[model samples]
Target: MTLHPQSRSERDPETHRAISYRTTGSGHGAIVRLMSPSDLGHLIKPFVFLDLFEGESSFIKGMPMHPHSGIATVTVITEGNLRFEDADSGTGMIDYGGVEWMRAGGGVWHGKEMSPGTSKRIQGFQLWIALPPALENASVDSQYLESGAMPEAGPARVILGAYQGVQSPVRAPDGMNYLLVTLRAGESWSYVPPKDHESLWLSVSRGTLAAPGLVDAGEMAIFEPGNDAVTLTALQQDAVFVIGSATPHPYELALGNYSVHTNPQALRAGEEKIAEIGVRLREYLRQPNDSASVPVFR
Candidate 1:
């Protein structure tokens, strides 16, 4: 579908209005950066950096081990599947609605934790959220949850926060809400933001949605800050997408090539921790028999 900007006059005043919009940009490999720290991330704060990717399972096998700190990554699979292996979680398959959450607290290196599953091709999103000060330097924690483990409220799957009294199993921080939703053609859904949630945006995986304004596939729409409710309607074909809302992250972002922290001191500490962990990771890989390790970005 042809993608273009939507005029203000075209939006319905009673529903949420699109203040800004972004289309995913091409990236180095089989991934696209939907949002990043250098771009719209500043406006969204805690909700920073989003990558949408799709490729054969073999494509992911090429990703090298990397390290991260001061942020948490959430991986959501919308199509196909992935095999997750970790000493703690053992081996399991994550298909549609499945999530892999990794809090790169102090520091950690990963890349081998997940491999291709039964599906030949897999499609999903990886979202990076800046951690709050208290948790940024804590020990790393990870979880792999299957589709059945996530709770559903109406057409939406509660991915990271509470919705309609259903809370997600993921131990995410407060003041944010993320949901995975699917709408059949001609179906409509309305979202009422929590009293404190001021930042809101959505990206569609497939089909078209009229969030009162036409949002084509792969396009992201950022709404004006407010508590006003938003309504969306699927145009043609079934629509699958993710929506997020959060209170502003109340700190400055000290950015690194692979990390984000609230301040420079914290950033430095996180990097130091990552360096220490890298040593252990390399040694572990050297003698690993069947241990599962998560992919780490440099």
Candidate 2:
């Protein structure tokens, strides 16, 4: 179903999608909550939460271990780098075009897997997708793909879905596409969604753009719901942003503090699993964490 579509503007609707809603979102410290499950999420469904974060002065060295279930998180680094270490992936830097995908299926506790990199300034977006019923309680799966490992299509990196016959290495679920794109000054690019994927939205991280209407840096805009392609011009400066389109999630968003499930029954089961996992996680954290970083604790 199309959501809060705006009245057609005079601009060529065939070339660019009109904006239905836009927000800079609320900011706390260096992180801006562009979209959350409780706000502006239902309209975007599977695409539930988004955060535009930049650590200017000093990035947090380590984030405390947290739990999540019934969702998958995709992290993209836009400005700087973050250090990632895992026993399977070893050590690497996640810079622009790099990605980290974590499916917190069933239940998982993680955080220290990534520490501060050499860059003093860091910026990126973390997006959470509500899991489908079958995969909601599946086993945890994580992938840390370096910039070189990710596929690209013209000006965009296929972050989590196939584009122009190129596919991302990360094994994300179907019916959604996430892209990280950069347009040089005066450059133009268009994004055509996959079949049946109606939900679409985007957030700018740097420079200004005109998807026919000005979408300045640091703003998130929800497109009038449809499958029409959107062409973006980078105005007079280079523009960098992340765009997402997906099939609307059909389940109710049953949420807990750190989890999202399809129904109340699933949420209760997920919460119980995380609570049990937390007890063991406290013990796991007490041990020396000096070896390789554990990317996921299921």
Candidate 3:
């Protein structure tokens, strides 16, 4: 059956008018930046920086450690799996539908927490969220939830927020919803945004979709600002994608090398904390006796 077709009402044309902006981000390697703070991020704050990544075990295992602060990173696995071995977080495999949420509050260094899993090829998306002022410099927290722990509302796995009364296990911020949805060939679905959620966007990881218009794999599209529902139809093969909607972030973004803050003072504080933690991170990783792969220094 057709979901929310545009014929609902004459006054609903603009609300369900497909998309207004789209992009296939530029990159030469196994990863693509679908949205960044410099580009689509300005249009959608809080929800900033999105990466679509796919790489082999060798590449995934060799990822260098990195540091961040004043923001949180959400990693959703779309295919294969990654192994997380740490004394604190324990050991487990994050496969399709699994999500890892790391709040780089105050400051922290990571990247080695996850190594290549049983799958030779792993693919997923990493999203960076600019935190509110109160949480920007708060304590660091991390959550690793596997597929079975995730909840679904229809075809969508609630990744970061509530949908149709189903709430994700990831304790993300309020005012935003992120979902990972899969549709069989020729299936149609409708997404109704929550109250006051005006920012809307989606990125396709596989196959094609018609929000009444074509959105091919590897491309991201932005819906025109409104609190309305969008109808999506899988065109050819199975469709896998992530969608997000939120209330606009109200603060100016103060950018740093690996941090985003509400203002210059916050940025400076976060960077300072990150730098201090980086020194300890290097020492921990270089130790011959330390077997802990996932180390959090703040």
lDDT of 1 by residue, 1-298 (tens): 1223456776666665564555655566678778887777887879888888887877878878888899999999999999988877778999999999999988888877888999999888898999999999998899999999999999998999898999999989988999999999999999888988988989888899987777877777778778877889999799999999999899989999889999999999999988888887677667845634544423
lDDT of 3: 0.85
lDDT of 2: 0.87
Residue 173, candidate 2: C-alpha displacement in angstroms: 0.6
Scored by CA lDDT, what does every candidate get?
Answer: 0.85, 0.87, 0.85
lDDT for model 1 comes to 0.85
Worst 10 residues of 3 by lDDT: 1-10
Q: After superposition, how far is residue 160 of candidate 1 from its true place, in Å?
A: 0.5
lDDT of 2 by residue, 119-210 (tens): 88999999999999999988888989889998889999999878899988888999889999999999999899986888999999999988
Question: How many Å off is the CA of 106 in candidate 2?
Answer: 0.5
Q: Candidate 3 lDDT, tens digit per residue, 109-179?
A: 88878888899988889999999999999888898888999999999999998999998889788989999
Regions more than 4 Å wrong, model 2 = 1-16, 287-295
TM-score (C-alpha) between model 1 and the true structure? 0.93
The per-residue C-alpha lDDT of model 2 at residue 174 equals 90
